[model samples]
Target: MEIRQLRHFVAVVTEGSFTAAARAELIVQSALSTSVRNLERELGAELFDRTGRRVVLTEAGRALLPQARQLLAGAEAARQAVAQVSGLGAGRLAIGTIQTLTCVDLAGELAAFHREFPAVQVSVREAPVEELIDGLRAGELDLAFLAPDARRLPDGLAPFATWQEDLVLVTAPGHPLAAAGRTLIRDLAAEPFIDFKAGTGLETAVRRLAAHCGLERRITCDVTQIGLLVDLVRAGIGVAIVPRRIGEAAGLPCVRIRQPEPGRSIVLAGRAPRPRNPAAGALLDQLDRLDRFDRLDQLDRLD
Candidate 1:
């Protein structure tokens, strides 16, 4: 009838005597006897035949034995399921990212996390920064890699890490800006630009930098794909401001921005209160470890 009583009954049957089961269970013999008797009473059936010196199971006892064992096994399995999630052995993690994030190797980092926590399911979604932030705030995403304005991060979001990266001007070969070794922000004001589509962090950065220079960006073409933007620049469609790493990789002529150079702070952000995903927490821990090791190595190089 009760789990404790079933456990006591099973122990008595296994030990072949009430005295031995009581000893095995670390309980008084009378208490063990009372538990078995209560179970039998609740079930309205006799569980044991006590006529002989060696007690044996009655028909009802044999019928209940397997079911009792199953119940105990089920209880144990439930506990183990909870333990797995609590220990970060298994769960799901939904992570979001912007289109441009060259500062960290996101794929490599995810692969490392998968190796360490093979049971954790990882899902990655790539979108513009604004949409990623919206997903984070809506609880649809557990973590996000973004370029958040340091002066105005969203209300309930917190940054886990931040790094600075310069944005360079990429133009077609022999373009005036590319021919010049250095150019100011205002210098590009009148030039036609190939820029990221609206709602992108890069687009916002371009606008901010232009506003700082007291100029308006003359956007000739807007694109959502980085590769297409680079191709457009290569084809002489228009010059564009992009992350320095991207420009270098595209082999486009890159000109340095001078006098309030364009740049952005890349951030790994999550909801401020933190979600209750053990897998997400584990991934974050792995990232922190790698970041700390990198910083320590940098310090060592200075020595």
Candidate 2:
């Protein structure tokens, strides 16, 4: 029988009469009776003994009472579960990020999300921009933080938020470049550079800037992690051009680039038109709230 029928049956049993059950259910007594009758007919069993002033359960009614109550309870539980997910109370959120996370504090945002929706499971993945885009396309990720090339995003993904950031030259404390208050792009043309792998957006921006200045980059070391690149610079292996925020965080000596300054637009990307996950929608709502108050910088303060 239908859930509605089961619900009416349970209400009648609890209220001890069809008239009271109808009043409790906000329905007419005759309609309630019809529903109960239809359910009894479907089950091929008499659910109540009506030969007395007050309605009471028969043998078959007693047998089905527990099962009908269980069915109704289960249906209610299902509705509540869906409501929790729709309201962002519980679910899993998969977030992807580019290897370098200088533009925004991804961990902090995750922490904020956790504080707000503790029951939601958050998963983070670090990869190259291309790989992040692939993950988005494949529906493996709910959101991504990336430095897109010239505002060029993947076909289906749209930028939720974007900000421009400059790239700076980083070196050891006593390095020759550090002594120079400011450096020009041409000055580092022949210097040994610690660069990211070829497929990274950072590397592409470096190469583009180098090409603009008519110089070929001499990559002494190739690294994947920004922290590792900073460590290499600290050890005097070679210099690196990275986001200013990264250099500042590393506490390395940073020199401003004068000519062909390398920079990129960082964006929070997600599926356009619609997001498949309810948790993703909730995260986007949080992001929107943060954006409205210009509080994105506050993410840096979170651990």
Candidate 3:
């Protein structure tokens, strides 16, 4: 049957009477009644058994009710998908991220996004992984870049993309373990350590590593900024665990953890739902383009 006819059919079932459905649909009662009648005629079954004032659904009507609703819902979703991709009007994107984003250059991507979609207001919040997850669940943030704790994520949060990276122990030039080819966690039990504040991704992962090795880390210093944490390590405040790429880039001694080698997943996560924010969708599209360009550059190098 026609979509309009199905819409009218659902309205009548909802209001329980032709008069009420007509008022609800903002049409004349006769028109609503005619639409339902036409639908019934096409199906070759009497839908509603009209008893005095209240309308009751017949067998045919009961079966059709669910399918009719499904069709209508599908139609609405299609319409929204089309509208979102057609254009981006004025909007805003509230984004959250972790302190260490070594895998992807979010700053550079956001800068490019700003130049292209200047009308879209974008705000970034840097927080620990736990806080970022809470923000997404509470609807305070639209999307987040996180070093997720392994592959598990909250039920409603889904990753848009994931990149793997190694976590290495960083120490200054003069530290005793700095020159070790590969060290074990038990070897550092007595040494002072520099670690990120609790609730952070790196700290949590490092703590898990310590627990696995059955040793408590002597965290003599706690820092919020990754750069500051690295600097402290450079100055011999204490040894710290950091991303391999970041530690190497900082010119620090990055020793591999031979036992229980820890790795991290850098993921771009968003809430699982239909009709995502148009601005967020635009950002994803932009990232896709940039990723394609990066792949092309890699291929050129190979050539």
Strongest candidate by TM-score: 2
Clashing pairs in 2: none
Q: Report the C-alpha lDDT of model 2 over 214-237, residue by residue, as the tens digit.
A: 878788999877888999999999
Quantify all predictions' global Cα lDDT against the true fold. 0.79, 0.79, 0.78
lDDT of 3 by residue, 1-303 (tens): 898898799778755688878986789999999999999999999999986557999999999988887786566445445546666545667689988877878788889888887866677878989878976775546789887765567778776766767999999886777766589888888878998888888887788878888978888999888899989999988989888988999999989997788877677788774216777777877887777223211211221
Return whichever of 2 and 3 wins on TM-score. Answer: 2
Which window of ten consecutive residues has the lowest lDDT sum in model 1? 294-303
Point out where model 1 deviates above 4 Å.
1-86, 292-303
Q: What digit string (tens of lDDT, one per residue) describes model 1 on residues 1-303?
A: 787898799788756899988986789999999999999999999999999999799999999988887785455345445746567565667799888888888899999988988877677778888878876765557789887644556778766666677999999988877778679887776788998978787888887888888978777889999899999999998989889999999988889999887888777777775544566667777878876323211211222
TM-score of each: 0.67, 0.67, 0.65
Candidates arranged by TM-score, highest first? 2, 1, 3
Per-residue error at 25 for model 3, in Å? Answer: 41
Over all chains combined, what TM-score does candidate 2 have?
0.67
